[model samples]
Target: MKMLEGKVALVTGGGQGVGQGIALALAAEGAHVAVAGRTLATLEQTCGQITQRGGRALAVTCDVMDAGDIERCVSEVVDTLGGLNILVNNAQIVPLGRILDVTDEEFGKGLDSGPVATLRLMRACYPHLKGDGAVINLASSAAVRWDASGYGHYAATKEAIRALSRGAACEWGPDGIRVNVIAPHALSPGLRGWMEACPEEAAAFVRSIPLGRVGDCEDDIGRTVAFLVSDHARYLTGATIPLDGGQAYWG
Candidate 1:
């Protein structure tokens, strides 16, 4: 049987990048997907791809920083898909700046959009997520290491996500809800420019990985997330899975 057959999943930031990859992977496994993001065009594109492949999907435009938007996104998913079994909190905006370089506004925006938004979504989906539900928060390698020049704000927010995931798992486990975090180093549209702009740094980064390569967003991180949300990982909760090709260990 298909791993996610008859399940319904909501993927935040599903319009593009790693979130899009995860959404497609879940859909391919037979789950109905709700692709949520701030951009309708990108969400539509993702939904179109899933539908073209004979998967059920819906495009939902949502601003993660806004609680109202999150509520609407969850309501739409439950109403349209019947009920939500999985939620991938993958919406995040990384503002590149050092501690001193980043203003209060930028730091606030990063935290509000990343960890805070994830918490709001978890609360909104709590009641409906009873019995074998899964919540996967998208964290980053930066959460576990230093970015040096920039990314203090982004890293801080991701670290908060890790904490939130662990706490939520402990509290919700009794309700049959599993919470976990995924730290992925994958090639996506968002990271492509950085990789190209600093080829040596990027290449050196990839060489540190035991896998001898950077990850492909869809096949690598996406597949890992699908597994985590599937019955195969029913015993897993509050774990941080580093899908970074072992770069975290060496670096």
Candidate 2:
């Protein structure tokens, strides 16, 4: 049988990039997925792809910064998909700049899009999540490795998510709800833009990895998320799994 057969999943930022990949992956695993994001077009595209592949999916318009949107999103997913079995918190506004160059507004933007939204989503989904339900929060290698050039705010929020996931794991484990973080080095739209602007640096970064390659959004990161939400990972919780192709390690 398919690993996630009969499961219902919700993926934030599911309009594009890693979130889109994850939504499609979950659907491929026999789960009906709700692709939530602010953009209706992109969400529809993701859902369309899933439906074309004979998987069930729904496009939910949601702005993570809005509390009402978050609440409504969880409700819509449950209403449309029957029940919420998995939640993937994969949306974030990535701010790139040296620490000294970042302003309060810029830092706040990162927090609002990342940890704050993650926390709100978790709380919104808490009551709906039954025993064996799973949550996969996205983290980053920047947080684990601390590059120190750019990604200061991004790293901070990601680490915050890791901490929050650990807390949730402890608090919700007995209830059969598993919470974990995935630090991915997948090729995202932001990463693609960076590579185009600084091809040499991007190449060097790839070379530095022991695996000699970065990760693919759908194939690498998405599959890891699928595993995490499956019964195969039933014993796992509060762990940070690095999906960076040997670029970084986390204990």
Whole-model lDDT per candidate: 0.90, 0.89
> What is the model-wide C-alpha lDDT for candidate 2?
0.89
Clash number by candidate, in order = 0, 0
Error of 1 at 67 (Å): 0.7
lDDT of 2 by residue, 1-251 (tens): 89999999999999888998898889889999999898999999999999999999999999898899999989989987888989999888887788898888988988998999999999999987868799999988886564567877778988998999999999999888999999888788878999999999999999978988878889888888999999999999999888888877564
Please give the range of 10 consecutive residues that has the lowest summed lDDT in model 1.
143-152
Stretches of candidate 2 off by over 4 Å are none
Clashing pairs in 2: none
Per residue, candidate 1 scores C-alpha lDDT tens digits across 1-251 of 78999999999999888999999999989999999998999999999999999999999999999999899989988999999999999988776688789888888888899989999999999988899899999888875574446867787889899999999999999999999999888888867888899999988888888999878878998888889999999999999889988878424
